[model samples]
Target chain A: MNYSIALKTLVVKEVYRFVRIWPQTLLPPAITTALYFLIFGKLIGGRIGDIHGVTYIDYIVPGVILMSVISHSYSNVVSSFYSTKFQRNIEELLVAPIPNVVILLGYVSGGIIRGLLVGLVVALISLLFTPIVIHNLAITLSVALMTATLFSLAGFINAVLAESFDDISIIPNFVLTPLSYLGGVFYAVDMLPPLWQTISLGNPILYMINAFRFGLTGVTDVDIKLAYLMTGGFIATLTLFSLWLLYKGIGIKN
Target chain B: MKALSIRNLRKTYHNGFEALKGIDLDVEEGDFFALLGPNGAGKSTAIGIISSLVTASSGKVSIFGHDIKADNAKAKSCLGLVPQEVNFNQFETVKGIVYNQAGYYGLPRKLALQRTELCLKQMDLWDKRDTVSRRLSGGMKRRVMIARAMVHAPKLLILDEPTAGVDIEIRRAMWEMMKTVNQQGTTIILTTHYLEEAESLCRNIAIIDQGHIVENTDMASLLARLHIDHFVLDLADPLDSLPVIDGYQLEWVSDKVLNVAVPKEIGLNRLFAQLSARNINVVSLKNKSNRLEQLFLDLIDTKAKGAHA
Candidate 1:
């Protein structure tokens, strides 16, 4: 329905938004990833030995990249949407003839672009510390894209629920950050006790990181197929929910 | 056919404050219609509903016969809204802002650029096309907004307090440009606190207050309904005492000058008769039209007092 133009423009604008504010949006994540590679991968990897027949550095690479993807995607949507709300320019699009689905896709596509771009940068920088390898290019790309889309939708939802600048940071600080770090980003769920392992499975991000780790190193604590299915389910659910919120004009109308 | 029609539009905030209770209005094709009210008088709410920015609780709005709720896409395509706030993407140039707005309406890049240029030039913003929107002055930013709204060339233009904070010179220019647009067959609907502007430019006006339309009529008829005029009399002789004129309110500001309010039908003939009867020599007399500001204040004050009663 002539969505390609809308998608393309939105993605370009989204990418430009973060790129234009490189110090605030892009640099902090890159520096944080560097620290993770240094303190977690090198200092801790030497003590832990190996995980699933791979060195700790290589094992953590996929998780680090996936973490970057999730944070970047979520932040992109939240900040962009919140800024629009603050500036009130969103009324322009709200008053236009465009379909709600098109607006959803356009904003989501922007988030995806930022998430994937930052993910690529993180992956490339990891090579400086340790050699990287790919087990399945298709699975790797699919998992990364789907995970970005899912988190971007989540960010969109957060932005819609947020009423102020403080509101925008609440979910990321209290919910998203804690969920990502505990969702097996640093270690395999198998390393936990059986009860803890089962509980960790409940975290949606665990499935996404595991699927991505499997794509990169062909090793996973959970079944690779289950990981793929769960991530796909997440993407579908979040997309539908976000579209519903858009149609209802949440946070947009009084 | 009516270019725009609204029926029983109502809006209430979550905090239980009713911004718009119920308003009905109709703007004819090629008409320059103005919606006039004071701050917090529901002018913005009415415009917001018509432009689809604010949803009505229980009402209907249509653009050129298309129901906004049922055929939003078709209805919205026929409308262009210039909001009161200067909200825009600060990072983009003026040209980019206009172009992106057109793209949002599903226009192709080529067509969007063409329309953007045309609109920019029309708003006299062509010289500042490449500058970022943030760097422009307040007036320039307002002009950029007008350009963005006109990019799609909608059949109806809705402006919400377009010149609220602008200077008089810029406001005059904006009014002239708006008149040109109205002349081109794009029905213009604007809301403003400037009563003089509405009196001079609008053929029809609607006065909304407390979510209800208190007054709606042609400009001429509304002015005639006030039925008030003013006379400034210059006397040849110094007045130690004021002369009482029946059926006219008089104030003697100085010995040589006296101001009076008289019904329009009661011309200066009666005033001259009173002066001659009192042996007051008259040097010169001038008549002044009733100022719209007084009428607006009187209407709103009367309405407010009535509500309290």
Candidate 2:
């Protein structure tokens, strides 16, 4: 496999696919995130001033940005990949001499790009509701990258196992949405009771949102070190599992 | 080296359905080969396995001496398979689709562009290069598939029912293009329900039935097995019934059209003499069906009966 050319080509195709439908792929996130900032950051935060010694709006901005990354990243890979399987166009890559790693990374890169783009849009939208400030630029960007990659890999796994379009939506709707909302995107885990706090630790997205929040406000209820480690761990595990599935040709091959 | 070699290939689906039962096949380099089989006869499975779209259970396939499993990259690099269905992204432009396939095959940007141009031109799709594939007619979609398969210039190309929905004019044009490509030293394997296509284009053939190769031989040799010939005789005048003649089975297709099945041993001259003695002047006499169709039907029928036995 000439991994260079094959990977690049796949990346270009994936990018083209989403970019060609920008109204659907890129616009919805901006509008939805802007609405969140307007309602939660303005109206609600005006009533409740500071959260953990910081303005309520600033405290939630990082969480909102991270949330967008997670949603867009997962949706990009799930819908695009599931569509490929549904249409049977995956055979184009299957028959090629490209390695499974190249194919995986190609699709993952597409998701990452979309997630990052949507995350950027949401961040810009947040600025309209509050003054923008980055406490640690490195932590913020790294957390964003790690979260996007993790969710994209999750989406890929979901797409692989999906037999029908309905199967694709079940996880995002039932599992992903609930997990993200409870993951401290709007409030800190410290606000919950001891038992609920412990359960929040198990949610996994809590670590992600906390990690991004710490990068933005330097105030994360969870230990930032453990947050980074957990994100890295989930990413490594999902990456290995995805490669194994592709190698086995489990669901992709009959 | 053979263009393609399958050694005792077998595929038993998870539900205990054995789709391919240890079939062995070999196609010579640069030879136009036809793998003919009815629906569910495992033609698609065989192609799927060779293209690595489906896994083989117990045997090996080699392309031009490259083992498909051990030397997968090399083997796949030498082969292209156009599946039975249209599988390209329907929303993609025709040019983008072809270029992407070439890039996946590891062609550099420059080379991929050149090959894309040439293939689209050969398929007469140059004018529709910018059109989204789904907007084109069914025949055009099939042509786009052919061009996509040709992008990397693989040593061998396998087309599964490539002309299934194509009209006669486009199908003939496709045949001409394939013949020209074959002459340029690219081995081709074609599968179609149209027996006339196999008889006219392929030099060698293998007929699979019920997961087995019931007949595998050169085109001429296979045709030779059809010792019975059928003719459609047009009568000079309408007749209510046809007279019985020994050594011939006559069927009345219509008042003026009669289907005559004559054995090779009886000869056409003998049939003409029989008709002449009866004062029945024949307006026109044509072969009822192509010879390969007859042989294919016989082979499949025999295989079915054997399975039942």
Candidate 3:
């Protein structure tokens, strides 16, 4: 197989699909991030003093950016893949000479691109409200990319198992949204009660948020090594799981 | 070399229904073959398995001598399929759809673009290339699929009812295109409800019924197997009574219409001459049905009777 041509074609198609619908895929994240900063930063941060040696708005920047990455990355894959299945165009790939891994990579790369684009937009919006700082550029970029990859794989799994359009949205709405909020986005985990703080540790999103926060603000509640470990582990797990589902032809071939 | 080879191809759906019961078949390279069957006769299942859309319980399929399971990529690269239903993205432009299909086959950008243009032109869809596929007429949409399938230029092309809803003119045009492709040395397997299509295009055929092949032979031989041909003749002058014909069985429908079952060995010219001798002026004559349709029904009916027995 001409892997180069195949991969490039799929990536171009994927990028074209999202870029063609910028209002739906790109605009909403920027608007939502602006509102979050206005309501949570200016209105609420006025009374609350600095918790981590920075304004509350500044403190929430990394978390907000990562939150956008997580959801967009996940939604991009789930909706795109599920729609392909629903529309029956997935046969194009299935019938092609390319390996299944190429198909998986194409979709994952698309999700990552959309996720990071939205994250970049949200970060730019955050810069308008508060002067952004990056204590460690390497960790910040690594965590952002890794987080996007992890969620994209999760979304791929969701798409494969989804029987209907409703099935695709159920996970993001019920599981992803709550986890993002409770993952220490609006508040520091240390501020929570001891029991809730331990429970917060259980949320995978918390580690990603804190890791990203550590990279940007140089402040984190969890150990940075453990954050990378947990995030890396989840990515590996989901990658294998997603590939397995594809190899087994689950929810695809009959 | 055979363009396609199947051995003991069998499939049992998850619902516990056996669709294919260990059928074996083969098609030589560059042959235009027809696979005819009633609905639920496992034709779709067999096509699905060969196309990799459905898993077979136990079987082996090879394309151009490459095993589908062991050398799937190579086998698939040698094959193109136009499924019974419209499967491309409706939102995509016709050019985008065909170009991307070429890309999927690993054709480089320049080559993909060139081939996409050639295929669209071949299918007479170049003017509508920029238009979204869903807005096209049904016949045009079918043409788009044919263009897409041909973009990759696979050695073997499988068309499942490619002209099901197409108008007669467009359908005949498609048949010409298919003939051109076949004449260019591309093997084609066509399954259509229109037996006339099979008779007109296919050099060889296989009629399947109840998960078994009832007839597999060359078109000439299959038609030859039907010993008798029935015709309904309209007379220019109303007949008082049916004329006595020696070799043909005649039935009187009305003063103007007569039905005759003539033996295949006896030519139609002899029957016309005999009627002329009897002072019966036959103005027009039409077959009860196409010869192939009659033979197809007889095969299916005979298979059903044998199964019952």
Candidate 4:
């Protein structure tokens, strides 16, 4: 199979879908990230001096960046795939001789691009409030990519389950937003009460945010190695689940 | 060789609504076959099953002897489908959509581009290659869809209502292009409401109604079985009493025109003899009803009454 060309074309199409509507895809996240910095980092940081060794502004940057990545990647796949279903264009791909794995990868790759691009924009904007430092660029980059892939797969699952536009928003509004907020985007799990801290451990986004936090500051609320292992594990699990969904022709067929 | 073979095909949706029921069909290589059905008939469901867009509840479909369930890749590689709706990446250019479709079938970039150009030029869409699909007119967009479907040049091409919303001019052009494609050894299956198109283009036809094949035969035989004919007689003078024609039925539509129906075994000579004997002067005559419209309506109406009973 000419997988290389297929992958390239799929990736380019994926990127162009969101990029063509930058105001809808990119600007909203940037604006939201800026507000988080202004209200949470500057206004609230004045009262809370230091949660860890670093100032509150520097500490929350990684979490905010990771949050943006997760949201952008997850939303990108869900919306793009759902739109294809809505427009009935997905029939073109379904009838083709291509393997399901290629379709999954192509769409996931698009989500990852949007996630990474938005994360970069958020990071640059965060730097205006405080100079951002990278303690381990490798760890930071790998975690970001892997986390985006994980969420992209999750989004694909959501899109498959979705029957309408309202179905698309339900997960992001009810599940994703609540999870990200409670996952330590603004406050470390250590600062939460014992019961709340125990509950936070079950949230996968907590691991992602803390791992990314470790990569940026060389300090972490959880073991950084455990963070890496958890992120990688989530990616593998989601990948297998997505492959099974594709093989069964889940929503595309029936 | 048979290009497609379907047996006992069935499809039921999640809500327990059965869309298809035991549809069996075969299209030989190099034949243009038309599937004619009403709006709610299972034409789309049958196409969906053959193209693998919808899973079957029961039964089997094979393309060139390759089973759709067991060896789907091989089966799909031999088939190309142009869906009823204009579904494509609207943000991409026409060239991009065609090339990407080729890539989905695992073709290299160079080969994809070459085939894209060929198909687009054949569809008269090469000039609009760089234009985004959303910007093209509906007819042009449908042409792009045809180009995308032909990118890989499959042996069997299934067009589901390809001219649903197209203009007469583009529709004719599309039909010509499809004829040329079929002439090149590709088996074509078309589902359309345009009975005239089927009459002109298809040699074999299957009339589907309520998920079953009500009539499947050669076009000539199907039309012959209906036993319908019409004749128009222009009388030399306005007549108060119509001439009683033999071996035919006649109705006076106007004072000067006599509508006539005759069996194939009888000729116009018998009708003329009867008219001449009655002192009915005939100035001109014409045959008006080799049409399929009345037959289709009668078939549907009969089926509906049978189901209600």
Q: What CA RMSD would you report for each candidate?
A: 2.7, 1.2, 1.8, 2.8
lDDT by residue (B1-309, candidate 2, tens digit) is 899999999999999989999999999999999999999999999999999999998898999999989999999999988888999999999999999999999999999999999999999999999999999999999999999999999999999999998899999999999899999999999999999999999999999987888888999988877789999999998886787888999998888899999899878898889888988889999999999998889889888888899
Q: Return the TM-scores of chain A for each candidate in numbered order.
A: 0.95, 0.98, 0.98, 0.97
- Model 4 interface CAPRI class: medium
List, for all models, the DockQ compared with the true complex: 0.58, 0.87, 0.82, 0.67
**Each model's C-alpha lDDT?**
0.86, 0.92, 0.92, 0.88
- Evaluate residue A106 in candidate 2 and report its C-alpha lDDT on the 0 to 100 scale: 93
Q: What tens-digit string does per-residue lDDT give for candidate 4 at A1-254?
A: 56667677788888988998999999998898898888889999878988778899888899999999999999999999988888888888889876778888999999999999999999989987889889999989988998899999889888977889999999989999899989898888888899999999998888888888888988777877787788888888888888888787787777
Q: State fnat for each of the candidate structures.
A: 0.63, 0.91, 0.87, 0.79
> Between the candidate structures 3 and 4, which one is better when assessed by lDDT?
3
- Interface Cα RMSD in Å, per prediction: 1.7, 0.8, 0.8, 1.6
Q: lDDT tens string, model 4, B277-309?
A: 888888987766546766777888888899999
Candidate 2 chain A weakest ten by summed lDDT: A124-133
- TM-score-better candidate, 2 vs 4: 2
TM-score of chain A of 4: 0.97
The Cα error of candidate 2 at residue A248, in Å, is 1.6
Q: In model 1 chain A, which range of ten residues has the least summed lDDT?
A: A1-10
Instruction: Give the per-residue lDDT digits (tens) of candidate 2, residues A1-254.
Output: 68799999999888888898999988998898888888888899878888788888898898888888998899999999999998899999999998999989999999999999989988888888888878999999999999999999999999999998999999999998999999998887888999999899899999889889988888888888898899999999999999999999988998
Best by DockQ: 2
lDDT tens readout by residue for model 3, A50-137: 9789888888889999999999999999999998999888988888888888989999999999999999999999888888879999
